[model samples]
Structure formats: structure tokens, C-alpha cells
Target chain A: MVKSIHIEKLNYVYQSGTPFSRRALTDVSLDIKTGSYTAIIGHTGSGKSTLLQHLNGLLKPTSGSLTVAGNHITSETKNKELNELRHHVGFVFQFPEAQLFEETVLKDIAFAPKNFGKSDEEAEQVAAKMATLVGLPDSVLDSSPFELSGGQMRRVAIAGVLAMEPQILVLDEPTAGLDPKGRLEMMEMFEQLHQEQHLTIILVTHQMNDVANYADHVVVMENGGLIANSTPERVFSDPDWLHKHHLGLPQTTAFAAKLAKQGVPFETLPLTEKQLAEKLAELMPQSGGELHG
Target chain B: MVVPFVYAFNILNLYFFMFRIMVLLILKTKFERERTMDGIIDIKDLCFRYSQENEKLDLSHVDLHVNEGEWLAVIGHNGSGKSTLAKAIDGLIEPESGEIFVDGQKLTEESLWNIRKKIGMVFQNPDNQFVGADVEGDVAFGLENQGIEREEMHIRVKEALQVVNMQDFAKHEPVRLSGGQKQRVAIAGVLALRPKIVIFDESTSMLDPEGRMQIISLIKQMNREEGFTVISITHDIDEASLADRVVVVDDGKIMGDSLPEELFQKGNELIDLGLDVPYPQRLKFELNKRGIQTPSEYMDEGSMVNWLSRSILKN
Candidate 1:
């Protein structure tokens, strides 16, 4: 099977050689399958952000190597080669809307493509398509990005990155600070992009619901190290382990655990509300009578 | 004769002093009565517009009443005028046509100073509100503006930090602290002033899950334990569930005002308004749709779990 990202013994240090030097990632190694949706979860001071920066060659490893989309990135890799790798992996930082600078929304979205060598017409075309994909109306494309609401500006910024058409998309808390509806819309957009475009998506968030809803694979990070790499079901099935790490289970899984504690029988833990409901229905008597009456 | 004259003078002084004390006591109780009767914050026919160029009013003929020590949550989508309401209450912006009575005093330019003292605001971005070099410094900045005595400022700052459970990180710089810690310090700054009302304007939106939880618990404690009225303007449904009252704002109007459970009972309607129902509430709805009968009181996960274990599993 093809791998979207493969890291071997990767280590990263911030402010290396200074008195304040700290190891952000220690011998972290993981493999991301091509076209898979991955969510990285951790508390503050965890190395999730550091590891994400390495996916797109934004941060060079102090040791070990990372291969992203066919480009091998190591401490010794040239800057020119790293830039080439970045084009294949688009990175969206936290509060990406803060990065918007162009006068018009269309211009901002087209900036990256034009910088990557697309013609003005070609870049604008790609930008317009991306804007539509992110659920922005055509009427707002010409308006000043600053004039748009926070959620709209966020979409415009996302469109800017999507216009690059990267095979691998890495987002850091893409839905942070958005309203509930906006949050759902943003996640759904990314899910659609991943499914329809067959893109490899890596999301870094503290929200377990987002993980349970979208992520097929889960990577748990703690204390600058990779702790667990498994499916979301496996990662969240054990409540004690998650709580020990200061992590919370998705509400559905937590509810399932609560039911289990009260002597509800389940062959396997359910990771979603629908699953729990289905399991409960199966345990009910076939008479279809209301139990509470 | 001289002794008799001195006795009369003393008696007159005592009478005047007693009269003054009585008047002061009456005024104080009258003020308290007004505050308790009308609500700590009373808004009537409130209207505001960003500028003449803007076609629609940001807030229009809105009426809201926040009782003392009540936790009121304001929820809405972006551009829904929730933030404008917060700003208006804090005296940061003047409403085009409305009257805001904070602590029984009408909000006006002349009364802004006294009104500001009653309401403390914590904005969305933690970085924007941090004006000091360190946590301790930041907490003390508010007191310094009020010209509090040096020794008294130190006492209040320490007390505030203790309230937010950040007493140990007093010297930490804003840059070094986590998002949660910075927000705690910001809250500490507000607490030092001892404001009667605290407005949280999406303060937890930028934090991670743990951070958000920390701030939420702190807000709850402030309302329940300290008796400070809270007005939290947010988009988070879980946070709104903790409030005593939830007000939904849409298009600069009060769309719905009710208990969180009642509001969420209109599940799809809320979703259509760009709001979300709590997970347990949504799950109950889904189960009902699938022909399963969930207990009506299952508004949270624990209760739902209990019901499922006892009722469905027993059968």
C-alpha cells in the first residue's frame, strides 16, 4: 500500500543549543496511509503541532527522516527541495483567517497558485472553483476579505490553501472559534473534499467529536512523544486510558461507557450515538412495547 | 450657664449625625431594592448601527434583563448581534436608541465611568487583552487604573489570582503560558476589580477542549460561589447548557428565550437557525425517530445511560 507520509525516528528541538532549548518531538515515527483521514489528539504542550509542521517540511527534523508524497525530507535536505515538497502538502495553521491580506477574497485565494507558477487566468479559475468548494458565494468573491464575517473569512483562507490542489492537506484546529453551524459546515466540507477528491487529510484538534465523526485513524501524542496509533474506535474504547492522559472521549462513547457501567451488555464498545442506539434496540424485546410506560 | 450651653451644642451635633446616618441608610437600601427589582442589567428598546453606510441595524429594539447572580448565555451565529449586546452592556458602544440601566443607573456618557466599574469584560482573544508583562502585572493593571493604593492593589491581585487558581503562575509571561492559563490570568484581572457583572465574549472559543472546560467551570464557580452575574456570549452549545437561561439571537433580534432544554427541544429549528443541540438531546431525538422510546428526562448522557440500562436492558 502506498504511504502518504512515513517518518522514521523523527526528532525535533526548539531553540536548539540555547538555555531554553526543549525537545518538542522525541523519536516520533508514524505512517499515514494514502487517502486516509487522520486526527491527532493531545493536550497542551504535546508534540502534535511539531509533528504536523514536519509533514509539509515546514519544520526540519533534528534527526531521522520523513518522506511526504515521494519527497524524502531529512535535516540535510536542501531548502529548494523542501519547497517542492511543500507544494504537495498544504498546511493550514491555526486561525488561518489571520493570514488573509489581499484586498479582495478572490485575490487572496489566488495568491498561492500564482506564486506556485500558475498564470493569472489559471490561478483565478482555480481560486473561483475552490471558493465554491468551500461554500462561498460568487457574490462575495470580489468583496474585501476584511469585510466578511469570521466564518466567511476562514473559508476564504481555506480556499487559498485548497487552490494549491495539494495531495496531502494538514490542518491545525480548522474549526476553532467558529460557531456551531460554521464548525459543522467546515468539517463537512473537509470530509467531502477528502472523499470526493481522495485527498490525504490530517487534522490536529482537541475535539473528540470531530475525531469520531471524521477520522478513520487516530494518533495520540503526549509529552513530545507518539503514545498510541490506532483506529478511533480502539483509541476511544478504553475510558480509563483516555482519562489518564487528560483526554476526553467523544460524548457518544462516554455515554456508552456509562451504560456499560450500569450493566448494559455490549459485545463491543460503540463509538457513535447511532451505534449505541442500534445496539440498545437489538437488546430490546421484540414486542416493540414501550418499556417506560 | 456655660455648662448648659456646651450640653446643648453636643445634643445638636448628635441629632445632625443621627439624621445623616438615617438618610444614608435609606438611600443605600433604596438602591439595593431598585437593583433587585429591575435586574442588575435592564435593556429596553435597545438599538444600534455600526454606521450610516450600513443598511441594517446591528441591534434593534432589543430588550433583555439579567438578574443578579444569574448565569445568562447569549448564543448566535456570526453577525447575529450578540457581541454588540455585550459591548452595549459594558458601555463600550453607545446604542442608537435605547436605555441600559446597570445597577439602577442609566448608561450614558456621563455615567460611563461608574457603569464600567460594575461590568467587566473579557474579550475572545486572550492575547488582545493582555497588556502587562507578566500575569501578576496584568492582574494588577486594572486596579492601577482605578488609582488603588499600592498595598491594596497587591492584596486584590493576589486574591484574584487565587480565585482563578493561577496564584503559582503570577510571574509567568503571557507568551509562555498556555491558552488556558492566559485566559485564567485575564479572568483574574477582571476578578480583581470585583465587578458585579462579568461578560465573556466568546472567551473560550479559541481554547482547546481542556482549556474550554477549565474556563467554563471557573465561570460557573464565579456565578454560583461568588454571586457575580454572568453574561457569556458564545457559539458553544455545551457551554450554554450550563447557564440558568439561554437567549438565542438572530438578525439582531431575540429569536428565542427559554431554558436550554426547552430551546433544544426545537431541535431542527435550532439547527436551521445555525445553532446546535446538545449531543444527548440529539441522540434522544434520533432514538425516537428510530421507533425507540427514550425517557423524557434524558437530557444528558448519564441519565440516558441510566435509562437505557434499567428500562431497555431489563426487557
Candidate 2:
């Protein structure tokens, strides 16, 4: 697999060399293996969003280098090539649906590709394909983007990004306020997009359960720096550090903590309740001592 | 025995006179005192639509009386008008045809300022709501706007930051905070206003799961410890499950208003409204179909385990 991103010593100072200057990311470095499902998890103000922005050249790093999917993200890069790079690495922002303002949902999704001078005939077909990818019906083609429900609008907006046929898909808080089912579907879509499309998927989220079940790699950021980078099982295994940063463990971890007090030592800390339940069932007593309760 | 009867008769007559007076007084005071509580955000046949001649607001025969110190969760899908209702209450939008009474003063043009002071709103996008360059400055914005005294403003800013546990970030720039931290500062800004009621308009929607948890936990603390009434607008059914009462709005009207368990019982109706049940609620419902017993209060994680353990033990 090709290495999609190779960022080296990237530094971003908010005010830059002034009295008010604050270093958002200091000497940060990471690389993305093409088609990997990576989650960037962090507390508020961890520069997680800032780092993601750098990935797509949305925000230029103050010093050092960033090469995403293939283009170098620096002012020295030619504008034409940089624009093409943007076409390859899609950035779906939080509340992306709010960016939709076109008359119809179909046109809204087609806007990005059409901006690149794709023929209207070609744009419409791409839009329909993208719409299906995000679970939107063909009927939504004529409905006003603003008139659709929030979840539908969110999906429509995502379809808009997918319509561009980006090789690298980056989403910020894609399922922040979604219901359980919606969250599950959104995460599954991430896996599907990565697996089926061979897309390098970078998801920025605070959901531990998602990080637990889906992400191939998890990166945690705190205090304007990347602190922990590991697999979901390893990251969630030591949730104390997460808690110290004012981050919360998944409910299953907390439940395991409770059982620890009851003399039932959890063999492992499970981030999802299903895992916790199954683990418990496997550890259930065949014949126990006196019931203490 | 004859002497006792004479004293008892006099006392009995005196008690009867007071009882009649008390009955009339209580009846007279019922609605009047209830109106005086700074509670009861009353709306009358409230209506608002983006534009007229295009089938204006479909709301009405509508009535809701939120008591002081109560936490009410409003749940709905996009375009369900939950936000529109919040906007009306916050005076962001005027009801096209109808009236609102906040603490007894109708939301007339002249009374809106006062009503707004009583209700502090936190929007979904914490970034846009931020007006300060730094954390301390941001929290102080609401206080400064209210023209609070300089020294008092400093004290209030500190207190509000402490309330959301963002005191350490006081000197940090608002732009530098994490998605969750920025939200806490935004909430602190509202807290400095000392509003009687705080409306969280899905404020955590822009945050990650971690950020979302911190924000809500702080909000709960504020509501419980600070004695402020809270109205939360949420799409997360799990978050809605934590609320005392859940009001489900659908297609611009109230579809269900009850405790979370009761509302979730209307399974298909809720699904049709574009909402999903919380995890345990869904699990319990599914378990019931399979002859497994699960109670509603077990809807929470810890309690669910305790219930399951005991039930399994009994068998």
C-alpha cells in the first residue's frame, strides 16, 4: 500500500512569533498508510482539528513539511497542483450539512465536482452514485437540501464530498450527536468506504466505542499535541490517562471498574458493552461461595 | 365532662371560621402564585413559519408549562421545529401569530430584553457563539455586555469557569481550546449571565463523544447544584434518556411528552419520527420479545448489570 501522508515536524503557531503566539502543534510528525482507518481522538483544544486541517492543506503548518496523498502542503506548491490535491483528499467538516445552500439536494452534492468543470451530465450521475453511498434515496434529488431532515442533510452533504471521488476521506465529528443506530451506521460506512473503496479514512471523533470496535489505529491528542497513538484495544485498556485529560471511558469500562470493587476482577477492560457482557458470561461461576450480598 | 364540652364547642367554632377563609384563599392563590414563580414559559397557540402563503406554522392547540428547576429534554429530527421553538423562547424569533409569557411578562417587543436576561442560550456551534479572544475574556463577555461592575465581572468570570471546570484555561485563547474546551468556555459565558434558565441547543453536537460527555456532565452539575432550570435539545437518544422528562417533537408538533421510558414505549411512532431508542431501551425491548425480563430503570448501564445479576441469581 502506498503511504498517503508523510508529515514531518509540522509546527503551527496560532499568532506566530508574537507575544500572543501559541504553538498549536509543536514538532508533530505522523504518517498514514494508504487505505487505513485511523481515528484522531482528543480532548477539546488538542489541535486534533488543526492537525487534520494540515492533512488536506486547509491550514498550512508554520514550519516543517506535510505531503498528503501526494502533494506537498506548502506555499511553494503550485496552485493548480494544490487544487488537484484537494480533489483527492476530501475534508468533511463538522456540521457539513450547514454548508449546503444549493436549491436541490442533488445539485448541492454535485456542487464540488461541478466546480471542477465536470459536465452537468457527468455530475448528475456522480451525484446519484454518491447519494446511494450515503444512504440517500433518489427522491432526494429534487428536494431542497435545506428542507431535508438533519440526518438526511448530513448524509447528503457527505455524499457531496464522496461525489468528488476523493481517495482520502477525512471527517470531523461525523456522528457527534447521532443516535446509537445512526452512529453505528456511520461507523460501518467508514469501514465500508475504507475496505471497499480502498480509501484512506481518517475519522476525528470522541467516541470510544467507535474507536474500540472499528478503528484500525487510534491517535489521541491533548494540550495541543499528539499524546497517544495505538490500536483501540491498547488505548482503551488504560483509560485512566484518558480520564485525567477530562476524557471519559466508555460505559463498559466504567462498569468493569465497578466490578473490580466487588472482587470480580475483569480479565480485560472492554470498551463496548457487548464485549463486557460476553466476557462476563465466559467468566461466570460454575459453583460459587456464599452469597455476600 | 360538662365543662369540657363547653370549651370544645367554642374551639370548634373558631376552627370552622378559619377553615372557610383558608379554602377561599387557597383557591384564589392557585393560578396567581403559580404565575409568580418565574416559571411557566407560557406560549399560546404559537405559530411561526419561514414564509407565509407557503403553509405557515402547523403548531398549536399547543400548551406547555415548565416548572422552575425542572429539566426538560426536547428530542426531534431535523426540521422538527425543536430549534424553532427554542428560538422563539430565546426571543431569537418572534412567533408569527401568538404570544409568549416569560415569568408573567408577555414576550412583547418591550419585554423581550428582560425575558432574554432570564434565559441564556448555548448554540450548537460553540465556535460562532464565542466573542472573546481569550478564555477569560470570553466568559466575561456576557458580564461585560450586561455592564456588570469590573471587579464583580472578574469574580463572575472566575466562578463561571470554575463551574465548567475550565479555570486553568482562563489565559488561553478561545481558538486554542479543544472542541470540548471551547464549548465549556461558551457555557461559562452563559453561566456568568446568571440566567434563571439555560437552554442547551444541542451544544454538544459539534463535540466528540468525550467532549459531549464533559459538556453534559457540567450542565447536569449546573442544573442540580446551581438550581437552574435546564432545557436540552438533543438528537442523541442516549442523552435524552438521561433527562427527567423527554418531549418528542415531530413534523413541527409535539408527538409525545413523558418520561423517557414511556416515550420510548411508543416504538414505531418514535422510529417514524426519525428518532432511535437508547441502547438499553432497545436492548430491553428486544429481550422482552425473546422472553427475557428487563425493566425500564435498567435502561442505565450500572443498574442494568445489577438487575441482571440478581435476576440470574434468583433463577
How much lDDT does each candidate structure score? Answer: 0.89, 0.78
For candidate 2, write residues B23-49 as lDDT tens digits: 999988996675655565777778777
Writing each residue's lDDT as its tens digit, candidate 2 over A114-152 gives 998899989989999989888888887899988776678
Report the number of the highest-lDDT candidate. 1
- TM-score (0 to 1) of chain B for each candidate: 0.86, 0.83
Could you report the Cα RMSD, in angstroms, for every candidate shown? 5.2, 5.3
What fraction of the native alpha-carbon contacts across the interface, defined at 8 angstroms, is recovered by model 2?
Answer: 0.22
Worst-scoring 10-residue span by lDDT in model 2 chain B: B290-299
Query: Positional deviation of A268 in candidate 1, in angstroms?
Result: 2.1
Q: Give the TM-score of candidate 1.
A: 0.92
lDDT of 1 by residue, A28-129 (tens): 989999999999999878988888888887799999999999999899998888888878998888899999999999999999999999999999999999
lDDT of 1 at B146: 96
Q: Tell me the deviation in Å of residue B228 in model 1.
A: 0.6
Report how far off residue B314 is in candidate 2 (Å): 8.9
